[model samples]
Target: MEGSNEELNPNAMTAEQTAALFSKLRRRRVSVAEVEADIEAGAPTNDAGRLNLLTYTAWMLKEAGRGE
Candidate 1:
């Protein structure tokens, strides 16, 4: 089910799209500024400046462990 959803959904998105989708998924307000800040802080993005959701999630999880 998850794989099918993954296949149907676009992997790469602009910061605005990413923020909107993330806000929907998390049921919270995710501002584009926050996403852009993450990118500025070294979150991965493709050459086209679109972020890969999977890659960003992985990077975020890895970063979350840094404080520990």
Candidate 2:
């Protein structure tokens, strides 16, 4: 599932990479802006401005459980 020249690091992906990776996994179109919005909404990202798949997924699941 290596779509780009640079191997995607699931533990530390840029928003675009994250969106692309997730869109593939989910079989749906996930936009980079949406990922960026998630970061703005407090989805956790590493200090290097990269997202960890597990952490981000956990945050999303937690948010969903909140039912807000």
Candidate 3:
């Protein structure tokens, strides 16, 4: 997967081009607080969103050494 991502990378960049290829995605990046608030509010209304919230929380706990 990383190979495919790198294959399309330009030869010159600020790590891969002076400008961001996916600027819109970069701009809309969510904050941890927002996800927590959404989860608390049951905002997803879908399985995927719930899964992502759980996964993100799990990862966070794991990184903080609070998860088994």
Candidate 4:
């Protein structure tokens, strides 16, 4: 049987949750190279721009974690 949405996603974060996380990362000022790596690894095909943004956000999160 297919899992319910909650079961499929234990964290149950919404798009708003994703956006908030991205926003925090943006405030950290991550580097472009790191963002490119994340884009290569995480985003779906033909979604270069979205992936780029998400990757950049992820990089920012990492940088923020390091206090950069």
Q: Which numbered prediction scores highest in lDDT against the true structure?
A: 2
Cα RMSD (angstroms) for every candidate in the order listed: 5.7, 1.6, 14.4, 10.4
Sorted on TM-score, best first, the list reads 2, 1, 4, 3
Model 1 C-alpha lDDT per residue in residues 1-68, reported as the tens digit of each score: 22233333456788888887889899999999999999998999999888989999998899889993
Q: Point out where model 2 deviates above 4 Å.
A: 1-3
Model 3 clashes, total count: 2
- Per residue, candidate 4 scores C-alpha lDDT tens digits across 1-68 of 12333322213323333444445646863444544454565533233244333444455577568764
TM-scores for all candidates: the values are 0.81, 0.89, 0.27, 0.28
Task: For candidate 3, write residues 1-68 as lDDT tens digits.
Answer: 13335433222222122123323345754454544454564433244333232444454466558442
Measured by TM-score, the strongest candidate is 2
- For model 2, residues 19-63, the per-residue Cα lDDT tens digits are 888899899999999999999999998899899999999999998
Worst 10 residues of 4 by lDDT: 1-10
lDDT of 2 at 61: 98
Q: Please give the CA lDDT of all the candidate structures.
A: 0.83, 0.90, 0.38, 0.43
Question: What local lDDT does model 4 show for residue 58?
Answer: 57
The parts of candidate 4 lying over 4 Å away from their true place are 1-25, 45-68
